[model samples]
Target chain A: MMAAEKDEQILAMIKSGGNPERGYRMLMDAYQLPLYRHIRRMVQSHEDADDVLQNTFLKVFRNIANFEERSSLYTWIFKIASNEAFTFIKKNNRHAAFFDKGENADELESRSVSTSQLNGEQIREMLHVAMEYLPVRQKQVFSLRYFEEMDYRQMSAVLETSEGALKASFHHAVKKIEDFIKSKNLY
Target chain B: MEDLRDELKNIGSRLDPAGKNESWDIPEGYFGEMQNMVLVQLHESKSNRPNVNLRNLRSGLYAVSGIAAMLILAFGIWFFAERSHSIDPAGIQELDQDQVYAYLEENIDEISLDMLMTDKQMESEILFDQPQSEEDWDVLLEDVDLHDLNNIF
Candidate 1:
């Protein structure tokens, strides 16, 4: 079935108070990979990503009843995942004192090689390193807009902020990253 | 705006399929495990509601027991007071002085050997017995010395 048709069927079953298991399973199957990657990028650690991914779905299960049909299920799920990611970041920022020993250039270099076709691995590493320097909100906005390809309207819904503000955050994020790259002569 | 959009697109392309082919695959059976965990929690919540109800019932029983104990205590006191009144109604009545003396006189035979011995014994008896009259008491008081009255009256 088309994704929309499937979503409608799931909603109907959920509303009827029928077993939510099948519906929840369907949602997990459909969105797990994308959601995992999104969290992985946000947290920057595989174990943390795995932990948050499970928490995200657990939240989806518990709160699915409260999901008003005002927005698409896709947007609702993404919003939940994003909130979890931001919560993780806030918790970790207190320990930023421990994490601030300059970026692991070697680790970034290794990871960037996979995407070396478009930009050299070093440049990509430079970009990622610059990303780590951004304020939490800016990094989130930048990742959602650029990597996730979420538009301002969608991002507004996920971030629960105005579209204008999201755009401004993205703008500032891009400027900072570009300046960092140029100053370091990374490209 | 177009330039910025292109730059963002370029960034997006670079970050695409992030961590692809890395060993960061989602653990096996993760979704199933999550579903099971949630189901277990939901079931626990369902059972927990009854435990709360039972706690409320226990407290209610305690309250009823306390009230019953108080009622029993109150009834015990009332029962004892009522039984005492039923057994001794005349004892509860007020008595005049003459009535008190009459009662004592009526019981005099039982109270002493002198009263039991009779008139012959009374003629030989030397123990003083006063008459129950105010005039005799005053005459007796006049014959006695003031010091003797102080000692004997």
Candidate 2:
């Protein structure tokens, strides 16, 4: 089905309140994979990403009544997921402190590459570790832009920032990540 | 924008030149199991919601009933107060003849109209009760003979 039509159908089913499980399941099936991948890129741990993803969906279900449909459902759901990610990270002070004291990428690469099955996987890990050095918003912007390849307009809706600001943040994030990879000689 | 794009392209080319490789792994049956887990939580949360609202509803009912009881009590007091205030002290009703005769027979010695009043009040009121208004005078006049009034005067 077309995206707009799918959204309307899901909303109608939920609002009808006759069979909620169908609507909720449909919503889950449609958004889960992309949201999971996005969250995984942020936290870099499968377990944490799963937890965040669950929290995001639970919130969406609980607050389904308040959804105004002002933005596209895609933007609305992603915005919830993004906020959940940041909140989870903020609440885990130990994790926050670890990221605060930036990891040594060279050491991380040397230790992690031995266990990694492929050079590509190791490079991705290195990239994830390098991402830890970025400020939180920049890292989020970079993940949405570089990894997810979302345009500034859609991102603006999700992040609730101006398109110009998102573009600027994405640009700055790219520069920072490029500098980090070069500095570490990960390439 | 162009410069940032170039930088991103360079990073992408150097790091993941062939982008077809999958780097992440998941345990078997994770996605299939996750739907059930989330749905269970959703059901649990929604089910728990009505209990809180029921508690609130109980308290609200109690408050309404309490206010109703207070209103009833207040109205009762005001009604009784107005009823008692409406009675005029001097405007006593004509007693039943049997009740009056029975009381007179029981307390014949103690119930002298003379002992209960001064002679002057008896002369002015003609041995019934004080005539405080024109209605009382009229009632007394209706019960007395013209010869008795001439004798009293």
**Residue-by-residue lDDT tens digits, candidate 2, B1-153:** 444356567545343424523357777888878889999998898788755587889999999999999999999999987886678433335567797678779999888778657888787765465778998888767878899879989
- What's the TM-score of chain A alone for every prediction? 0.81, 0.85
Native contacts recovered, in order, as a fraction for each? Answer: 0.07, 0.32
Angstrom error of the Cα, residue B60, model 2: value is 2.0
lDDT of 1 at A25: 69
The DockQ value obtained for model 1 is: 0.09
Residue A49 shift from truth in candidate 1, angstroms: 1.2
Off by over 4 Å in 2: A94-108, A111-118, B1-22, B51-153
Which CAPRI category fits model 2?
Answer: incorrect
Q: How many residue pairs in model 1 have overlapping backbones?
A: 0
Query: Best-fitting candidate, measured by lDDT?
Result: 2
> Candidate 1 has which clashing residue pairs, if any?
none
